[model samples]
Structures are given as structure tokens and as C-alpha cells.
Target: MTRRTSKLDRRLVAETALRLLNEVGLEGLTLRAIAHELDVKAPALYWHFKDKQALLDEMATEMMRRMAADTAAPPSDDWRDTFRTRMHGLRAHLLRYRDGAKVYSGTTFTDTSYADGMEENLRVLVVAGFTPRAAARAWLTAYSFTIGYVIEEQAMGPDPFAGTEGYDVEARAQRLAAYPLSAEAGREMFQDHERGFDEGIGAIIAGVEATLLRRGA
Candidate 1:
């Protein structure tokens, strides 16, 4: 019923930090802030996490745990379809909180619970005729694309596409009147991120199929 407890643990601290993250965002979230939200002294958090970054790493791990729970099993085994589904699911997971992508990026996972899932992902590629190294590279490429996309998406606003809040094609066109094509291009580029995301994943998968799978590389 209460976030406060007699004993503070790493998981509780991480979960509290995640809830606070939505309220304060990454720039405002801090170990002290999390402690205050938990109704504990700042020093109590240090017993579980050595520092703020350590706490952040745990939070990212917790996010991954929730993501994994949403997909009980991997998707279909057609390598391209499987990867596309994974990338989309990953994007949804990263969009779950304020600055979710920023919180997830560059953090070392705190445990090995992710190993089985990673192995399963790589196995799908390998079974589809990718060399182990190529499979790893391909997966990483897709992952990097999703992370970068979501970071920019969150930057635009909580709901970048609800209206023309951050990406007003007309405004962009007006600002770049000297270049009609680049100005109008904003509609294609920013007007429909869902389409862009699907196309981007498709293009990446197609490229991998053309270059790696085709060449047996």
C-alpha cells in the first residue's frame, strides 16, 4: 500500500525511481528525489545503490523486465518478420515512460535474466542462415535504429503525433521557403512517424537480407 518499507532493496528503489521518473523526468530525477518520494532518507538509497548512475542502471533493468513480460515468447520465425516485430515491440517498451529511451540507453544491465532472450533472438537469425557474427550485427543494427528513433520521438513531446505540436509541416515550409522540396519534405519525414518507423525497419531488414543473407556473410 505504501512505497515506504522497513527495509529498502534494490528492486524497490528501482521501481520507485521509475514511477518518479514519469513525474520528474530524467533531468529532474535524482537519488535524493527518489528517496524523498519513497519517504526515506537519501542515505537509505545508498545502501542498495552505490550512486545515481547505479540506480539508473537498475531502473533500466527493471524496464526490460516489464518489456519481457509483455511478450511471453518470441514472435514468428521468419527472420525479417521476427526482427520487425521485435523492433516495434522494443519501441513501444521505450515509449512507456518519460525519456524512457534516454533512461535505457548506455546502461549496463544489472543481471543475466536477459541472456535467454538475447540468445533466442540470435538463434532466430542463425537458423535463418546468418553467421553468428552477422546475426549479432544485424540485431544490434535494428536495436540501435529503434533506440535512436525513440529518443528523438520522446524529445518532440509525450505524444509527438497527436497534433502538429513539434512538427508542423506548414511552419517548416514557411521557415525554409528558399528550398521548396526540403520544406515540403517535412510532411513525408515528420508527418507520419509510424509509417517512417515501419519503413525504416523494413529497409534495414531488406538491406540485411540483400547484403548478408544473400551473400551468405
Candidate 2:
């Protein structure tokens, strides 16, 4: 059989790896698997990515690049509000593929390499009067939270509030027996993760503003 590659480059390899990632998840994602997706021999991929980690870095870059392309600033120019919108969009983007956050966490995010997209993120904060260090910290803090949040979100999978469904109604009720508030809180919290993420982001942004931007430290 002909090697499936059509002059494979880093972009093609990364894009193919991304699709495989969504289908098979991070653990299942391998260089060989990406090579198969690219219709090329595994070794053909090495001409573009030296190893799985290199491929992963490129994949992470692609994911972040796509998110930057997809994410739009909020209607208003208020930095905090715009930041919130971006954070929300970031969470949604990270959740696009299976174990997306896990893959992202592993990337080197090199400035001179494939799919490096953190510049705009840092620029926004720094332009808003954040010291370079503070801006990096702010973006990283929000990004880290989003990653951690999505890890939990994906793990929760289907029917997070298990007993809420009709089939498990009885079991759910019994499990929550004598703990009405716990059941109520779970339902409220899990039912609307967007709100929870927003709240957490709001807290982080607010804290940063109060402590860093205000104090000018």
C-alpha cells in the first residue's frame, strides 16, 4: 500500500492528531495512531514530529489556536467582562475533545513553535495595566482553573446527579436521604456548570484586581 502521506508537515500531523484525540482521547492518542489518520507510515510522521510529546505540543497548540479563532470578545470593552467571556469560551473549547484539558496541560507552549497562541491572552491583560508578571499570572490562573474545572467536568460524564434521572429515582432519593441540603446543593451546582465556572472566574478576576491591579504590586 502507498504511504498515505501527502507531503506531511507539522500542520497536517497536528490536525490529524487533534481529530484522533477527540475520538480516542489522550491516553489512546499516539504517534502511530496519528500516522494512521494521516494515511502515512508512522515514521513519516517523525519528519514532522520527532516523538509523541512533540506531536502533543503541536496538538495543544492547534487546540489553543482554534480556540483563539473561535472565541470572540464580549460586546462591551470592559476588561473584566471581556476576560470572563474569554474564560467561558476557553472552558467550552477545552471540553471540545476527550481529555482535552489533559492534553493541553502537557504542552510546552513554546513562543517560536507550532500553534503558540498565548501572546494575545497575555497582551490583553498587560494592556489593561497589569504588570507583565501579573498579566501572565492572571491568565495562567484563569487558564489553570478552566483546565482543572473541565477535568472534573468531563469525569462527571453523564447524569452527574445520578438519581435525578427517572430510572434511578428511588436509588437517588435513598442515597440523599436525611441530607436534603446536600442533595439540593448538588442539584443546583451540577445542573449549571457555566454558572459555577463563571462564579469561580469572577472570584479569581476580582481577587486579582483587588490585590494586584489596585495595589499596583
Candidate 3:
């Protein structure tokens, strides 16, 4: 079936932009491309979004909206566990499209869906003994860490050097022959990224709990 985008809504435009993001990434995403996908003239798109940035902002908002939906129903009552799970989930969602984290980072979401989720999650923390401000801070702290982490992890894309992004003990050893200790450190540092991600998030959650508990958050 042919899709008609003659009368477009912001949501429809944003959703189309998201599909383009998965296919062409952020750099290739353009108003013209979106128009082509929607089967409409590029000028018709401006009726919904003023410029690419406006469309991008809507895209970012839509990503958050999806994230909010994913985390809507908390599986656990333990605030720590809930926060940790959601952080991991957010990372997974952000990694879905190329430069997903960058897209989200570029714009602010001015939607109530995100706002409502924030308020509800903040209440969870507040009830768990965190002051209102502390609750917000704690969530933001986790959010910042998650986004930053996914950004870094995703940045190591497509084997930047010689198509050897996987385990290369021999190649690495030969490269670091002059510096044994540095090579060992590098090996350990880069090896087992999944473990590192898991541990890093675990530590963040534990650290937050300890700090907030000590300060009576």
C-alpha cells in the first residue's frame, strides 16, 4: 500500500525520521529524504517542521517517548533494582539505531509523556527516602551515565582499525611488545565489554545507594 504524507503530523514526521535514522543514520537524514519516504513534496514537510533541527528535536522526543514506554511498568519495587534495570534498558534502546544516543543528546524533549514518567520515577525515589532534589539528581545521574556509556560503546563501531575489533591477543601482544605492562593493561581494558558495562552500571547503582543512604536522601 502507498503511504500518503500530504497531511502530516509532527508524530508522523518524527516516526518517519526515525526509520530514516536506522537506514541512513543521522548524517543522511534530511527533510528531502523524509519527504521521499512519506510520498510527499519536501515543501509539505515544512508545514509540520520548520527545519531539520526541529524535526530532529521531534525525533529525540520520540526516542524518549519510546524509552518512557519501555520503562513504564516497573518490574521490581526496590528502587535501586528498578533504576538499574531501566538504565540498562535505556542503553539497549539507544543502541538500536546508529548514533541513537547522539540524536537524543542533541535535543530536549518538550513532551508530557517524558515529564510524567520523570515525575512518577522521582516519586519512587522520594518515597525511598530521597529528598525531592536528590531524587531528581539521582535519576539524572544514572541517565547521564547510561547515555554517556552507550555513546562511547556505540562509537567503537565497524572496526576502526584493520577490521580487528574482536579478541586479538596475538596481534595486540605483538603491537605492545615494547611495553609489556601497557599491553597487558590495554588487553584487560578492552576485553569483555559486556562485563564492563554490567559492572559499571552495578557500581553506579551501589554507589548511589550508599551515598544517598549516608546523606539520608
Candidate 4:
């Protein structure tokens, strides 16, 4: 038998880990699995990543890198439009992989590669008359909403598109048969998440303007 030799670095390790994530998900993902995918020993990964958390951080950074690269259109100047576009894009990005939101959540970015885009976002809000603090709050609010929404969205199962058979709306309605509205709500909640996300984010951005920006103005 011949020994397999491969060059290892943070990028390769992280990228490999990300590809495996769609198959194994966050729970099943392990350092050994990543090593196995790379055809290297588990110990070899440690030279690049101190632990699984470090590896996760890199995976998240790579996800963000891909998202940034994929976004070709120029960002809108209006703060609300900018946020709406970003949040929608984020949901789509996270939905691309199983448990993508989980991978992103709570992982400290391995580097400042995300800073420039972030800076531009904040600048847009500030230019639109948001005080710096208010801009941060508004961005955070929209961000939290997007992340949380995608977490639930991904939880619906493997099918990212609307009308995924994995989630049984009729069964849910039957389960809630005693309560008609609650029963009907299954279709709304489960059938089309895209619609819910759009409405929810619009309300959030509008609420921010009405409450925070207006009061400040």
C-alpha cells in the first residue's frame, strides 16, 4: 500500500469541512470526518486548527467569503432596501447547506475579511440619517431576525424550496384540528417560508424606522 500525501492548510481544511457539513450536518460533523475527507490523519488537522471550534470558525469565514463573492449587484443606497436585500440573500445563502445557520451562529470569524462589507452596510445606514448607535442596533436587529429565521427554515428539513414533503402541513393541520386558525396556520408557517421571511423582515425594518429612527429624528 502507498501512503497518501496531501498539502494541508486552514483554507483547505475549512473548505473540506464545509462540503462535508451538507452531508453529515453540524451534529455528525467531526474533526476525524474532516480528516477522513481530506485523506489525512485526524492529528494532521490539528496543525492547522486547534480544535473543532477553531475549525467551525474557519468554516463560517469561508461561508461568508462565498456569500460576498456571489453577491455581484451593487448594494442599494436606501437603508431599508439594503437591509432587505442583504437579509434575503443571507437566508438563501444559509439555506444552501444543511445546518448552515448553526455553523454560522456563535462562531467567531477567523479573520476580518467580513469587515469591509460590514463597514459599507453601516455607512449606508449612517448616510441615511441613522446615528451610529442606531445603525448598529438596526443592523443587529435585522441580522438576528435573518439568522433565526434561517435556523427555523433549515430545520424544516432537506428540501430548501417551498412545498417540501418533509414537513407535513396537512398532518399538522389535523393535529391542530380543534383550532381552525391554528390548523390553517400550518400552511402559512410551513408551506412558504419565503413569504413569511419577506413579511417579517419588512415589518422589522419598518418598525426600526418608525420607532428608532423617527424618535431620533
lDDT of 2 by residue, 76-142 (tens): 5466876787788878787777777788885785345323345665666667788888887777788
- Candidate 1 weakest lDDT stretch, 10 residues: 157-166
Model 2 steric clash pairs: 4-39
Which residue pairs show backbone clashes in model 4?
Answer: none
Error of 1 at 147 (Å): 0.2
Alpha-carbon shift of residue 209 in model 1 (angstroms): 0.5
Error of 4 at 212 (Å): 1.5
Global lDDT scores for all candidate models: 0.84, 0.71, 0.77, 0.84
Which candidate comes out best when scored by TM-score? 1
Going through the candidates in order, what is the number of backbone clashes in each?
0, 1, 2, 0
lDDT per residue (tens digit) for residues 1-217 in model 1: 1468556789988888888887778989988888888888889888888888898899999998988778756668788878988899999988878889999999999987677788988999999999988899899999999999988878865353332356566887999999999997877777567788999999999989888776665
Tens digit of lDDT per residue, candidate 4, span 13-74? 88888878877788899999887888788998889888889998999999999998887543
- lDDT of model 3 at position 216: 69
Candidate 3 residue 75 C-alpha distance from true site, Å:
2.2
Q: TM-score of every model?
A: 0.92, 0.77, 0.83, 0.92
Ranking by TM-score: 1, 4, 3, 2
